[model samples]
Target: MPDARLVDSKASFASFSNVLDARLLRALADLGFARPTLVQSKAIPLALENRDILARARTGSGKTAAYCIPVVQKILNNTAASSSDSQSTRALILVPTRELSEQISAHLRGLVTYCDKEVTIANVSSGTTHHLQRTLLSDKPDIVVATPSKALALLQSKANTTLVIDEADLILSYGHDEDVRQIFSSGYLPKVYQSFLMSATMTDDVEQLKGLALRSPVILKLEEDEDEAANLTQYSVRCSEVDKFLLIYVILKLRLIKGKCIIFVNDVDRCYRLKLFLEQFSIKSCVLNSELPLNSRYHVVQEFNKGVYEYIIASDESIKKGEQDVESEEEDAAETKDDNCDQSKSRKRKHRHKGEGDKEYGVTRGVDFVDVSCVVNFDLPPSSRSYTHRVGRTARAGRSGMSLSFVVPEKEWGKNKVVGCVESTKKDEKISARIEAEQAARGSKIKEYKFDMKQVEAFRYRMEDALRAVTRSAVREARIKELKTEILNSDKLKAHFEDNPLDLEYLRHDKPLHPARVQSHMKHVPKYMLPKIAPVAGAEAPADSVAQDVGFVPFKKGGDRGRGRGRGRGRGGKKKSDPLKKFGR
Candidate 1:
């Protein structure tokens, strides 16, 4: 490893010419990347020099390209210098989630498009058969991307290999500490090799990984520039439990928020509940959660980026549960027998079904969501860290974005038990306070946004009717139905879609999952029922006489001409004519 050094600040590279190969520079241009990001500009030069690096940069700061360019450049350089014809795995990239492994592999493929004949990569984190993975590894691909568990089988000493751990902080949180220990202690790492530990935050777990994986490494902590910081605007709305649903319905149905938006919830059940609720209004949205198959999850993200769906209801359930597990253990240690019993039941209810919600899946940390215009936190996260990552999905790559969070006031937490979440009821206020403090510490603020309830009141009864239909049983049925549909459409028709591109459009994820009663009239907003536009300030005020003369009619007509029991026919009890029903006559 190179001697340790600490650098505070530096200018970004003007271009990718000096540090990157011509082929890589061409690929960058083709991919529409104008210049190197701050982290990329600084780390690429040092990494090319074979220096170990511990770098911290926020999400969407181009950290993937920062390390990938150097790795590819070094591989190209090594192949040119060596005379051996035998191919071998020279670089190993470890990520926390399967989604991240796939994302990195895709990016690497893009970077190596012009040089695919010479460079090859494999992603072992993909849920393929073990036999197939072993076969792929037996061929000795140039680069291997995997989760720590997947890399366990491939941890053997190889000469001049490079080790890169992306999202190092999340690796341990995903419960891979033992796998990490085995890799580091197995004595399989090459004596002379470059190492990179990349993370978004400097957590204790990250420090622990650094000690095991790096020696005398240079530390680079890059802060977001002024432009980057100004791109994101954050707001929080205080509302009751039912109001959360009402506000989201109004915001989405009325197009108050535009462009692709990600609505985040705290658990798996909540994902389907919100999805089913939105479906009542004929608003289509896809669901992305850990319970779904890996292929389906990846495909959903792909479709979202391509604009096949405008809204996605996602769950950070696994990540939140991971944090909750540790906290619950601490509470159990200090609490009494009654408290322990209650927690035991809660655990059972949370984990009723295995191989589903209880996995290492995470949407907040590593998955890439492109061009998100807004993030709606249907349920406030359990911690400030979770909140940060949830909101980080938007305002990426210098594009403007907005984040709107629904905070349940303490007094209104459980007032409406039907739509209330236990976790949110117990911890929302505290978590919201911490989030505000954390943001303020970082020179940002989360302002309170108040929606005019009187104006939104017209939609409340409709929201109630919609909410009534989304019972627990209905949510469960929808969840199972969607899973079965995804397996059929995504897995069974995977080959067909590949061969026929146009057919992929018919494979929609946002199709309505209507196990509950769906009312056709609820689909459209009536003109008169629409919220009236507020009068602009400084405009001419209507005279008192004119204001008094105005009637309840929305249109300019004789108001009471059509409002009579007789209907201008007679005061006799006669059957009203139905022209459509008597069309045959």
Candidate 2:
């Protein structure tokens, strides 16, 4: 059974004076936290009694404070009772990202400001000087907030009494489950200590992690209020691949976005590409990707919060890699290098692509941006969970916001179909099946998530109307010419265009319009234009239209089709050919 100090559902922060330390209560008051949030009220008391907690709450629900307050209270009480070394670590907080670790550290410092006892706190993570981390850990602080991998490396000497994993879902998603297990089984932590796992979304993976980490834990699942979703306006726009940038430009030009906005892309390359495209239109923006140095990433975030840039584009790439993996790769490369100088240079070229691997960290879960008014999904996220996290950046703390996603129709680049598979050969059957199964599972989960379908449809219609209006507006022609002149005159874009002229082809020619398209476009045309314009006659067809015709051709399956002709043809045939056998050979 949990401790009696656990607060009731209706209890406020002031109501917990009997259970909470006086100094902690004073600090909370100074921070202007009069009432406890649902998670904080329920989880704090149980945590103070050394109870394990598995909590599921929405983002921006004060979950950080829920865990931080109890941990601090426990540490203060323990230090007061015993005259132990003030620098010894008692609590360890593990987060998925360095940004989150910094945020938690800052919040902990705020909570400890009013305490009479000197409570020391330190943040250890990658991208910081190794010597600095060593110095910080040498004189162990009362609380240490760190990424899982970094914590495991620096925590060999301390036996912490409590462990808190914030954004537990993200830890599993980044394949850091093993790193987490290593921390628990590292023989450094106490066998019996309080553990807390908090997440915005709960899934089977989180359940599995709970089984592995907790014992007799109290589960607190706070249902998100309908008012939270009511405050957010979620919608999506359907556009072709080539027109996506144009659509975004139109939206921004029309002043559809309000206040500060965040644009999320699926990978780093697209993140930069979108930034450059926006720059061509004289739209100033900054980018947040893993390739930037840690200091630069921090500066970008700081500047973004200060309103230095209206749009900050971020990538969803996982940038944390194990130190062991990095060391082993370097050793193997050194061992395989030939004595010849040219051979060494050739080897370097061969491994050039590997340099793109996740070598630096980027923004992820638990980082908070203040007063964000909108979140734009330049690329659709691969899962519903990602979608939730991206949109959760806005409408925080009961404020109203909006989220817009661009949905592009899938297309084929060549003869092969764009069905998720690289090839349509029989050898890829298993791989294709696995891909389809995963996609189907994600699709089912998204449907069950229950977003507002009516609102989404209405938003789509509105976007269509906006697109037509922008396309037919008299200012569009002048705007396009002005944009072209700017792009050609700007030194940065001019050089880029010289190197990659194909990127500007879309702007060079006006796309031909079909009769149906013209009719739809006419709906948005001004009344003055309607009187001057007339539909094209059939005789006006260009003589070269027939020459431009390119009929569709069906994709032919690769490899031998007859039975016994291929290696994996018949039931008695040789073992099925491995799809990756070519790379090995």
Candidate 3:
């Protein structure tokens, strides 16, 4: 909105592109980068001049090259420095994920490759052989790209003259904010050196980053376009717990919003369970959690990067510990009892976490993915804040995204059991209080929907009927207009209609309008779902949809799904059914 060149190019971007150090430009050409993105064009020039910058931009915006080109330019172009005493790492680039670190390192190599200067890069992604690190650090690298844990450990082992933080917000939000500070605590880099914190969102922690990390800094924020949501279309479905996975299976089969998706959840175990469930559907998926070793986590991330895994399920705790919900004793006790009752059924429901809200789910928190398009919250988020974040994962980077949150009106937040009313978080409290006050002032009506569990499918069918009725009425109203117009023109509207008796309304959408009435199963069903059953009927999703899944793994092999196995755990070499297994039989 402000009057500022988003990119630094004053005239033609080509002018500067042509002027780039020959080696760097050659590398750019090799990488197929002809022109710079708006952020890159603006940020790179300043960085080349050693004028520290703070520019805001989204991922896939070419920010990496914007900074990388100039830094590599300095390293390769340094003619005054002598090789004899010219030691110590000249630049350090740190990132949140090992995959990201590897990605940056890969690009850095390309950019520096064209240079005649013999420069070495130290890559500190997870599971790097210790012997390799010892050799590189002692021999000395001109550049180092690493994750905080590995980089910090390496720097602790020795010292670095320079450092950089790629996803600064991740470090802060993930309970590793202190670790970042500690990485610099050794006073390795100069106090006045440059530090970059890159991310799409501008949370308060991002705005406050410089105070703790850098000196007076330059700040540039790139606003997402007004049409960012143009490509995404959203919908919410309510379903029974038993039908939830089936619904996901159906959607994946449809492949409507295809490509890789990062499934978010609040719990780690559920992430693995969902991963396994998705695998059962023959979908490629992987899981991310704190319990797994760094290498295993790295493997999952790498698999995703390589397109080997199209789905990743992870928790909010790993993203940012304090922001998510802790599994209280109540949930554990209930889960334990259910597990003891029947292990198979319990396993089916294991990762499902049917009615639990986003607080306990990972995708409900602030972390986001690169190019996801659809966010599906199998269960609703606990509050609007969680809901806002969950759905925000998709339709990103100047593209459109959609969110779908599942609600089953009959069940409480935990299950079919009538758990006491769920307590609202600070965010929900604010929303509820503000809504009530606004309603009282305007004398507007409100609807409440209560939760019910058993009749979920039945209620879903009822709401489908009502929605169909409304849609039919709308169609009839349109026909009435045409008939009246025909009468005025003295033309035969009925003759044309009879000739084409197809259902025009059904042709409007691909998926059928059968979301299973969410109102019928709510602990406090909102009036919108079923005026009588709604806990709060007038409430609308603040954004659009909520996100729920973030981890993926395989729970069953293909043979288990075969009809020949005849259900009941399937294919354990059972004898033909006698229709009776009694003692006499």
Candidate 4:
């Protein structure tokens, strides 16, 4: 159950109509938001009163509107108080990703559409040019939704009266803690301003941010509906590394995947690789990663929503470009270069600097895809929290969804030693431990669902048959050619390679070459009909051996046929006892 104080059964947007301005109510009506979600009902009123709020709600439980409504209303109130000529940015909303920033900005724009006062809003993120953002900021929009790095950059010149950190848990996860800290501690903004921290999970990192950023905040914890869990059918498949993709192909071929699906990989390279592999099967799909331009990403999402594509392979790469650390070697080289040479190189670099698409902020968090019926974990998420977020992509807004995960069995090292497939390395082990601890701390559990072995075998067979249609050699060659062309054509890659020719050579030399598939001789043979290895001549026969009774000569031991030691007899003629005899006694 949710906190009793936060769950008002009679709570509606109209109930707060007296408190809210007429324009906002009209916007809500136009948007068809009849009732306030649990978080909205509780957090909205408290936020309207200008109280700092730390809130936890389910992923699709209207947390955005909960904070956005208050921030909009507050900005409008401040606007009404001041002169119409005054247009200072009053509210700042910081989200984790560009997709989320745009989403929030769009929603806020819709909400303030019918407002009497002209409430201008703008969104600033890494995808677009800083010049355009600066131009937009020069207008002094009443509210600005932005990513942390870009927001921090903008806040240096433009200060806000209110701050909202949506998906606060992701702020730390995406390594924006420092940017966030700078905004709060940097005297550029007001010493005292209203703040709101909201997320689906109340992580320790979020709590720490609350202590550092917010002044005495009101905590609102909303429970997830158990029925929502029931709405999603979770399942796991035990598979090998190679078989995972095969299984995916089989699932797709069989039409087992329902509606719009997202295949989530841990890194960008894997996402691209999987997309290419799916293409070999003639399965058309789009990719959503940081590598694509923001507009392209926006377009991909729109197309996906319109059923233009059945599947979109996404990656969990969330490191922003401004946050990337420059290599010391590059710095040293730059400092040692001649003035004229440096100027020439600078001009070349300026020419090469096309845009910010070179940055690798892959799609992990803050992406909401509509009608996502299923989420497939092409690779297992590093942590339980990641798993939660990935699955939360589906089963959103009270809709039923499904999540499927692939778990590889631990490999045996020796008779007694076993190693995990995913967490095989030390760093992976540490990360897995941290994820487990985080999940335990938050009381999150991953429910396991059983799958039938016959169905699995059938799928495997179908996958193997599908693989035969596309040769690994051909796919590898095609992929290599495509990559080489991409590298040669890309200004960023060409510039990077020019800086380090050895790296370019390495890329050419290390072009992906998948091993040729070998046909197994025993693949189609029945297990019972397979020939067994012949017994050694010196080995003792079985106790019920038909060969021994048919006058088969036994091998001599130590070249002494008459005085040989019998089976199970030691040199000292002692009989061995069971090791568990003591326990039995």
Clashes of each: 0, 0, 67, 1
Candidate with best TM-score: 1
User: What Cα-based lDDT does every candidate model obtain?
Assistant: 0.76, 0.59, 0.48, 0.61
Tell me the lDDT of model 3 at 413. 32
- Ordered from best to worst TM-score, the candidate numbers read 1, 4, 2, 3
lDDT of 4 by residue, 381-446 (tens): 655566677788876666666677776544421111111122211122233344445544555433
Candidate with the larger TM-score of 2 and 4: 4
Q: How many backbone clashes does candidate 2 have?
A: 0
Residue 157's lDDT within candidate 4 is 49
lDDT for predicted candidate 1 compared with the true structure: 0.76
lDDT tens string, model 2, 333-436?
Answer: 77564334544553464366456533325464678887677788776654455666777787676566666666554342122221111111111222223323
Assess candidate 1 and give its TM-score to the true structure: 0.87
Better of 2 and 3 by lDDT: 2
lDDT of 3 by residue, 1-585 (tens): 112233346454445644466666767777767667677777766666556566666544566776777667666555345556656677888776654665677778888886635567878664447777767777668788876666666773333433456655554655556666776676656656666666555566666665655565567687444343333334444454435544455345334345666655544444443444443334545555544444334434544545565666655443224332233234446655544333454445444644332221222332335546456665444433344455556544445445554554443233422111112211223343333353344332222212233323333443333323333234334334422332432222223324553522221111112222223232222333221211223554233221211101011111221121101111242422211111010
At residue 205, what lDDT does model 1 achieve?
Answer: 89
Residue range with the least summed lDDT across 10 consecutive positions in model 3:
576-585
Residue runs of model 1 more than 4 Å from their true location after superposition: 1-14, 319-321, 324-345, 538-585
RMSD of each: 12.2, 17.7, 21.5, 17.9
After superposing all C-alphas onto the true structure, candidate 3 shows an RMSD in angstroms of: 21.5
Task: Give Cα distance to truth, residue 190, candidate 2, Å.
Answer: 1.2
